[model samples]
Target chain A: MVAVDSHAYASRLRSWHPAEKAGLALATMFIALAAGSSLTEVTIAVLMLVMTVGLAGIPPGFYLRLLALPAVFVLVGAASAGLSVTGPGPGAGADFLVAVSLGNITTGFTAAGLSLATGLLLRSLAAVTCLYFLALTTPMVDVIWLLRRLRVPALLTELLELTYRYIFVLADLASQVRTAQSCRQGYASWSNSCRSLGGLINAVFRKAGWYSRQLAVALAARGYQGQLAVMEAEHGRCPTRAAWLAGLEAGLLVLAWLDRGHYLG
Target chain B: MAETVLLEAREIEFSYPDGTPALGGVSAGIIQGSRVAVLGPNGAGKTTFFLHLNGTLRPRRGEVRLAGERIRYDRAYLRELRRTVGIVFQDPDTQLFSANVAQDVSFGPVNMGLPPAEVREQVRQAMAATGVAHLQDRPTHSLSYGEKKRVALAGVLAMRPRVLICDEPLAFLDPQGQEELIELLEAESRRGTTVVIATHDVNLAYAWADQVLVMAAGKVIGTGRPQEVFQTAGIMQQAGLPTPWILEVYRELERQGWAAGGSPPRRKEELLALIRQAGC
Candidate 1:
């Protein structure tokens, strides 16, 4: 079975309209901010995450794995809140413990700090989840095409495309260099590692230079004039699927906005 | 009457920017409609010489002339020269860089500013010629090595060049694939496209090339018809190339006193016929 993840999402999303998706994502963020409560933001974040998991066909474990990286920040904040109470030292803290009001009374610094932390966590999670959905569902090509459509200049798009190509080429060359070094037993010692790494870098630079020259020759042979012209597909206007997705996104935005206003209660 | 030369290089010398001398004092000429093979070992400047054909590289000294016109460094003139002489690189991976096969093949014609319809026609014709029409929609990264080589060839053929310079066209092919390539090149030559190949395979040179130019240490050691060139023991030793297999068999037969002839057959079928006639 194909592993459903961010890469798969990106590939499938290549067929989508980037402008509409970007607009919807922007709308979702605005709605999330206007809904200032931690409860509202957390609810929206969870909903968005669930929708992404379902629509992208990604397993829940995929997202759980990503959460491991961000969990470090959460642990630090929670621990600081618990241990760094500014009142008095422990064992001189009997009076402080009796005097402290921990519930949502809103007077004590501890309660205010907890609320602020909760708000910050919810906001971050909501914003990150929304952006993650955007990244997961959008292909890099669609982003480039949308940039072109939005009049982001031709040179930038060309550079981006070439940069993508060169990255893959460099990655392949690095792997090849590593394999060659390993085969030659150059990684057996620290000095050998340093020498091998230096040699690899030199080789990579030389190969890249040679490749650029060859590219120039190939381009000249093909009569290239520095500008890249892409062959776009011949589909008329926006497809029906895009309109449906846009309407769904608008509906979700309105619902989130209303929930933030407490209109349902 | 002597045949007029289509391309000529006189005392050409070249060195890389790092001061590595690639080619030194090389002089050769290709006559119109002749199939020439450049034979050399690795790092012997065969590819560097091929790059000079269409002015991809300029000689530090001497001159390279095509169709009696000296190759210039001017951009417009270089484009015109490239239109006439197409190069197929040794590595198809470097040559075929487009996302799809059709786009890769159409690149040359489109870059030449052909009309859309004409470019499509050129691409179709090239794909048909190279037997890659079915692969037009396939991604270049997904193609097999042989298919990628064919796609690269089609990319060059779309330019409709009068001369096709192939660098090690059979380097990585199996025996059958090599035979297929030899036949394809022979057919292209018959269609009046001057074919110049740089290769390390002596047997391929003997079987396919009308004329062979052997190089050693950045110098042209010998140039003649393939049979005559292979017979020169000193030239073969200098080029670090073995004599052709058919020539070896002819020598063995001669030593055993079973064959008497003016010269041994260079062609494989002719060699078989001669052996049959000699009853061995």
Candidate 2:
């Protein structure tokens, strides 16, 4: 998670207008979800990967590793969808392409089930790639700023900003406590590890509370009056970049339209 | 003329909600345009006293005065007070709530409701002053400890407060980082801002502070010129503070009749010059 965050900050496209990137990702995602086919989904995924890795300068190895994380869950879900379970009766498994008897039941793979699973997997992955594109290019601060400009409630946006900042703080605190526990041999055994983990959580919780109090004091010292107003460096719209994004999305839309209802194995 | 007191605490007493006394009858006056160091061990109420200066924590038994005016807890008054007194907390993590450096530095100016252009200018100036201008686009969490400390100072400095209070400004910084931070604070002081720092480093307090306030147990045990306060062996021992090396060496030279009878040196160079003159 920390690596992803740092990569976002270091992204070559980080200085690009956040709205442009967000709009491109969201529009592509909408097209993929609405008019999705195997070809269209694959195109969306490829385009996102290119933008995230090639344009944004995210290393391909790291990007593939990140994609692999979601691929694991999607693979499991698609496998379940593809496998068909039928009754033990003689005619129950007639439609199954390949069947195996398991005690009182028969399970097999079916053509339609496999196709449905493939479509589901492709669509989910394409949508995920679109999100990763946005997350890898835009820092959370820019995202919060974009939300603020979109008239999201100030309370919600402020909470998001604070939460994003504190996530790193709490993570660091937790790791430090874990290290201290390990140094004291608190995790020398199974029971000891359990007790040590519990102690780490307790220590982090207490320290989080302490940090909150200190944050309040610090904020108040700076004249914080119920609002976390900050000045963001405005990024003016570049017609060239906007046009490029529009052209890319339009290409994806065309692909989606042509591939409507078309599925491939 | 005597220096005017910019901020004063009149025998202020405070305690936590659970009845642990944090500050007991603490009183000190920060002179305008002077660098003051509040030296104490942990839990000596330096942070609590700083909170009171900015109206973050109201005192239970006394009043805090800013520029001879009594501080009020009303919204307008508190706002005015905070605008005049900015605090950089001990930990940069708590003080910096924004996700990025420029946004964090701009928080104070934005809250002050300055015009966008003016706020931008102030943020730029503050970042430049703290030598963090290049890091303005960096994320807060990605910065090193020293960089974060500078950015934290930049955030407070953007407000252009008259009295800047830093809690443990030198804590957790490398030697080079400490030197850079002190230089920044010195620059701020040179600009006529009353810079106050809370630290436990006896040598730092002696060499850098124009005035020193030594606190032992929620009370100010000594307050005066650094030379006088640190030379007071009884108070230094009471506060659990060691004499600065320069002062100690100078005293040793004097004891051997190798130093002329005059005011003691506050810096290493000054002490060396004293010994050179004695040699002549």
RMSD of each: 5.4, 1.9
| Pairs in steric clash, model 1 | none
Q: Please, what are the lDDT tens digits per residue for candidate 2 over residues A161-254?
A: 9999999999998888888889999999999999999998898899889989989888887888899888866887799989988998898888
Q: What is the lDDT of residue A260 in candidate 2?
A: 79
TM-score to native of every candidate shown: 0.79, 0.96
Tens-digit lDDT track for model 1 on A141-238? 45666787888988898777555545556667888999989999979999999999999999989987877778767766666677665343222347
Q: For residues B128-213, could you state the per-residue lDDT of candidate 2 as single tens digits? A: 99999999878888899999999999999999999999999998999999999999999999999999999989898899999999
Q: Please report how far candidate 2 places residue B136 from its true position, in Å.
A: 0.9
Best by DockQ, which number?
2
Model 1: how far is B40 from its true place, Å?
1.4
Candidate 2 — which residues are off by over 4 angstroms?
Answer: A88-93, A102-105
Model 2 TM-score relative to the real fold = 0.96
RMSD of 2: 1.9
Tens digits of lDDT, candidate 1, B119-186: 88888898888788998755555577788888888889898988899989988888887777777788
Q: What residue runs in model 1 are displaced by over 4 Å at the alpha carbon?
A: A1-142, A189-195, A229-238, A261-265, B1-4, B16-21, B32-34, B92-106, B124-151, B172-191, B257-267
* Alpha-carbon shift of residue A62 in model 2 (angstroms): 1.3
